[model samples]
Target: MHHALAFLALSQLKGFGPARLNLLLQQCEPDGDDFYADCLRYLPQIPGLNAQQVQLCCQRIHNPFHGEWKERDQLLHWLAYDQHQVLTLGHADYPELLQQIADPPLMLYLAGNAELLHQPQLAIVGSRKPTIEGFNDARRFAGALSELGWCITSGLAEGIDAAAHQGCLQANGKTLAVLGTGIDRVYPRSNQPLYEQIYYQGLLISEFPLGTAPRGHNFPKRNRIVAGLSVGVLVVEAALKSGSLISARLACESGREVFAIPGSIHQAQYKGCHQLIKQGAKLTETIQDIHEELAHWLQLPESYSSSSFGLTTDSSHFSSNGLLSAKDSLPAVGAFSTAKNQQAVASNQSLELFTGHSHSADPSSSNMASTPDAYNPNLTAVAIKQKAPSVPKFDNPQQEQLWQAIAQGAGNLDALVMATGFNTGEISQNLLMLELSGRVVQEAGIYRVNLSV
Candidate 1:
């Protein structure tokens, strides 16, 4: 059996967590192959194992196929899919930054691009109901950073998380959605379209085992992976008790940089960002603030430099062009592939990541939708794409004026106010009407025409 499969079996033993599994692997030193028999032989000699513990270990090692992993077959079935993969702790392809965490997961289930796990990631997290301004900020920052070769990572929740992912997609950039549920499941059901988009265009990650559901406790656990996978975390908009705050704290604990966008003192949504700023997170207003801070890390040794993140050195990171290639830093293509598997595609294009599944048949074709109803969770993927959406006719000249302003790229609410010579209330009312009719969408207080019509 493959070592990963053997580790999966060993991982199923009761009482065998990541720490215990690490200890067992260290003692057995199973590099010679037949890890199960080797672990069985070493179980008796390893210290810290009582007689009963040793006996149980031996039983598990002797008959790993009969171990307690109820989902072993399910895992095998998932792996049979081209893009579905499991990276064990000792797997050569496991993310290096994730290994630095205090309690790393034994394995990570990956969908979409497994190679993206090696890319430089910046986590954007915030409240599920952030103000429109906050939503735009997350989207703008995500898009900007993606252009700089950063893979935007998020929990895939609503509000700020959705904006960050959408912005990255819009920019034709790389993104990773770390799920709180199993890799197979999409929670909130409302994000089904977003989930499908990432499944085809970006990466979906989870440390949870197969068949896991979205439980309250699972989100905090998921936040750690979001932080661990990133070089930094940015809290776009969050409440004091927000899960985004938890991700920021975890990033700090993991030695990753944390950035927070400051908001008004009176606003309830900005309180957590203020708290994070007070806790030494950088006060960020623009992407330049983030670039300056992370540039310091580029000065570190090769082991800690941006090259280690599988990101090439651009003009932003280096004074000269092409100082380093992303391919130079990452493992060769097909490192984790089997004989039947085709070679993984390179991440040379702005949007293309590794191609592990049949979805790679044409990676350049984008699936972005331009309307609010495009993400109607009730609609299937084919329905969303093939359905002839009705365009709402506008009888109000003011609403048409506002829509035209947004379509022309003057998306900021204040900008729209200036361009249309309308008061704040008038612009707000017309924009709301446009949004309601699916003619426009707003984020971070910026309104844009929705092309679905």
Candidate 2:
């Protein structure tokens, strides 16, 4: 049988989960055409498969197209439709990032642009019933980031999720919805229109069977996929027990960046965000705040680099390893290269603002928070000097160290990694923050001290 059919049959096995299925799949040759036959032949030898499970697999292999999998006809029908596909775990198109997760789905049912799975994605997740302000914040962030070439990924729930998808749509940018229900189903019937739009303009993805209805337990699995597929996750507004926090936790576990927008302490809905901020998720206020952290990790699209908002710096100074070298000096991107020149630029030229969230909390609110040794997301520049030894006039010793490193010609990720003994993620986050704040400049991939700063 075909690999997808084999995976579908194996998935229907009563007790087999992703872990055991993955273990079994590992033993089968990925390139083989008759994967079901291989699974049946190797069933007894596969560890953790009890006799009953082995017999069931053998029976299914003997009758690959037997009356098992009531949803098989639906799956086949969906697969035959335009732009519909099923990506098995071992499929080349299966997302590498999702595969890295602890328990990846054995298969993903996808609609719309399957190729989009490979693009840079940022997940925006939050409460199902959000305040108007929170809803607007979701839209605003999603729109801004979408214009910058990010594919916004979110669970297709109400409130924040809907707003995010709408925002991306408004920007005429790509957005993806990971469904808690099946790929063929749209929950909350209210979003049926939005679902149609995404099906044509973006992508719809799910790991559940074709007819799986929305269930409370199914969402956490959906949440994991949303978190797994993105390079970072932004929590707009969530209560203490919100599933958005779950996504943020999973993102943290996956080592992806987590950003939380802070709201008033009195607002119960924002407590989750505050809790996340306290737990080392970056305190995000502006799009620049997100950009400050994620810019280094993402390859900005050509439109972003050439857009009015981009800095046009020389690319020739880039080293063979894709990092900038310190040997050559290049002109800064646009007039913002210098602090004085930045003042001359029109105020309208400034980055867009999402005003629903504020930064009123004292930086010291993180007193109970544990600092991650590499990058402390909640640690502000002001608190850095207080937390660490004073480095002359520099307010942030980490930034100061990074600046000195760049000044000394350690210009790339690898160079900084070797020079400061910090990991790539730490260096990337810090360097991007410095660049966004105008204290440092990057030409091509190389980093340098902004003499004007």
Candidate 3:
């Protein structure tokens, strides 16, 4: 308790950030015969201890331990609760991965299963205002990954982060929520249920001290911890200027794998992911892609090692570029296979060629002659049924206007924004609705009216 008090005092001292405190601790090794007194005695000798820092340390050492009794008592009371504890930097239980970062927190206030801190974690993050499809993708990926025994780590924000947590929990898997605010307080207030779920089932971790409010700046600093604790980060959907990208960059800098799901190039939500893929981040379409990339770190069970979720481990399916080979013919299944075929074709072609009608078979082609559709009535029916659905009516004037603009050759987000006189956010929301409703199609950065309409 005494040592904790001294450490707490050092943490509160101005100008004593993690780097400086680490340096001071290395020099003095504040232990034995009244550690605080020893720190006061050798404060001046510490290499980076400026005069102001030295004076601050002296003042803290001179003050009685109970001087800030209320705050100290509060922390003690919090720690007294079951499963609530603090991990200092040098402690054996401290996560080694977090310590490897450039600026590790001096202490972490943890709630729930502390053992999870040692488990391999994969961070999933993205936009707070994700499209419905983006939300579903995050949930599906997180749930699948969790079932494979990897712990999911994320901030407890709304949208993608919340969906990730919910998915992991639904799979009865462990997850961790790294907070920008103090563990005692849940920001956004709306996440109270999620906070409770994580607190009871997984873990809640934060570097911020008790009662720290949710300040804007703290989140970016909090992002480093999210990336640091994970073996890799999966970005579902993030705009160009989002915190998810920051986490991805931090993960890259710390030598962790970065994975991004490619989205429609016309959506601003996917711009950051596109940028990441262009910069060499792994392009992940399915859980297999993630599992393959993190195979060495994941240490899968015998079942998973041989195959994943019943999908055959056909190395031939993947191309030299590490994507699914487009040339491989789709297996004859039912509607599921038809959907998979579309995805496979999308994967193989450039974004510009992903428009559903781009690869129509030519009557003069040799393959058309070899496999006559007239010989297989069932296959012909399936092919005809798999054709793109007709466009639906718009829900409102905004959506109608956006669709009309695209139909009028407003081919990009900026052009649509200009043509419809809608701001980026409004345009994005309407476009997403149109895309989801099959009224519009976007490939590469170009928007096209669904000709099937």
lDDT of 2 by residue, 1-453 (tens): 256776776777666786676667777866567666677777677666568867866775667577655566777777898999889887787899999888899889999998889988999999876765676578767866776668999998977898788777755668999999988888987677789889888999999988898889999889999999999999999999999999999999999999999888999889999999999999976565677667655664333333233222345533353222223321233533454233222111222212211121122232323333342212222223334522334546777778766554354454466567777687878888888877677643335555444
Task: Tell how far residue 111 is off in model 3, in angstroms.
Answer: 0.8
The CA lDDT of each predicted structure is 0.69, 0.70, 0.71
Candidate 2 lDDT (Cα, 0 to 1): 0.70
Candidates sorted on lDDT, descending: 3, 2, 1
User: What's the best-to-worst order under TM-score?
Assistant: 3, 2, 1
| Candidate 2 residue spans exceeding 4 A from truth | 46-53, 66-69, 301-453
User: What is candidate 1's CA lDDT for residue 437?
Assistant: 83
TM-score for each candidate, following the candidate numbering: 0.67, 0.67, 0.68
Please report the candidate that would top lDDT against the real structure. Answer: 3
Candidates 1 and 3: which is better by TM-score? 3
lDDT for position 326 in model 3: 36
